[model samples]
Target: GAGVSQSPSNKVTEKGKDVELRCDPISGHTALYWYRQRLGQGLEFLIYFQGNSAPDKSGLPSDRFSAERTGESVSTLTIQRTQQEDSAVYLCASSLSPVQPQHFGDGTRLSIL
Candidate 1:
């Protein structure tokens, strides 16, 4: 299949609301990752899922952020109590392995109004 895919290419929500973002990784890819990029900043790692292993959530900046991946296919990132600080582009990437390079999708631009 092609590279990772993210839905709702753009999102705008009110503050204190909750939002969910979806990601579909490349077929047969065993490693998937989520990242966030604020305006004028570099991408920040959010979570990583590899095979059946537990996802790495340490990179999630706050308890309001969480992610889950079923197997190696689709992954979702949920943000609770949206804030202006949460406004950014959410990106998804997939790799054949942890050691391999990742291919990223066009990020979902999120705005908190």
Candidate 2:
């Protein structure tokens, strides 16, 4: 029924600040993934969680990025000490797995000021 959704469709923050973005995946989906699409840049995988624990987090750009999911449901991405380079659309998607086509949310557009 319900598709994935992200909060604060747009966010503007100063550099060096901390920001948290939220995502709500479809019901019954067991896998959640986060990705970043920077301006004119290709999509970059951030992290993914299956069930309630994360098994792959290598895509995190640095210590400033972190995320968590609760039992294949809601997820949140947190950025510590935000930087201008981090400004982009943070997208969340969910599916059976990487091989399955994922449904994507409009994403929370973060702009560093």
Candidate 3:
């Protein structure tokens, strides 16, 4: 894929179920970011990984939300014990560096029942 690719464009699960969302960023990009956009709200930064540097997870809402990248390639966001309030579109983006423009994926829309 030329751009970021996210799997399972739409997901519907029970409130307590766990979910893992995958993102494959553009090849050669060193910076990757994950964001969550609630209905009618703007994007909320979730996590960021730049090369081998320590990731900045300051935007994570709780311990239930976690993300990791594999050697500047694929990244995955895992949500444990999902809640209804967690419903949103999970966006993934990548860039050459933190200061560069980002290319975003279509996102995975999650709905918790």
Candidate 4:
């Protein structure tokens, strides 16, 4: 693939709802990352996956946030009991390795009412 791909580019939900955001990294990429960007704020690293090894999920802000990736392909980020503060852009990026530059996909815009 030419770049990372995210589905349902926009999402709207009420408080307490749960949402799932999906990411498909570029083929052959071995490293994937998830980030959150609140309105007018900088990106915050959320999770990272490298190959089939254990993912680095320490950056997840709460127990409600989780992510999983299989191999070097698709990954899904799930948020439980969504709140107004949870509204933000969820970004996905992929790189050849941990030290390499990453290519990002258009983020999933989440809105909570």
lDDT values of the candidates? 0.94, 0.90, 0.97, 0.95
Which prediction has the highest lDDT against the true structure?
Answer: 3
lDDT of 4 by residue, 1-113 (tens): 48999977999999999999999999999999999999999999999999988999989999999998987899999999999999999999999998999999999999999
What lDDT does candidate 2 reach at residue 50?
Answer: 78
Choose 2 or 3, whichever is better by lDDT: 3
Query: Cα-based RMSD of the predictions, in order?
Result: 0.8, 1.3, 0.7, 0.9
Question: Model 4: how far is 39 from its true place, Å?
Answer: 0.5
Where is the poorest 10-residue window by lDDT in model 1? 1-10
Report clash pairs, candidate 2.
Answer: none
Off by over 4 Å in 3: none
Clashes of each: 0, 0, 0, 0
- The list of candidate 4 runs beyond 4 A from truth reads none
- Give candidate 2 misplaced runs (Cα > 4 Å): 97-99
User: Alpha carbon lDDT of residue 81, candidate 2?
Assistant: 97
Compared to the true structure, candidate 3 yields what TM-score? 0.98
Count of clashes in candidate 3: 0
- State how far residue 41 of model 3 sits from its true place (Å): 0.4
lDDT of 4: 0.95
Whose TM-score is greatest here? Answer: 3
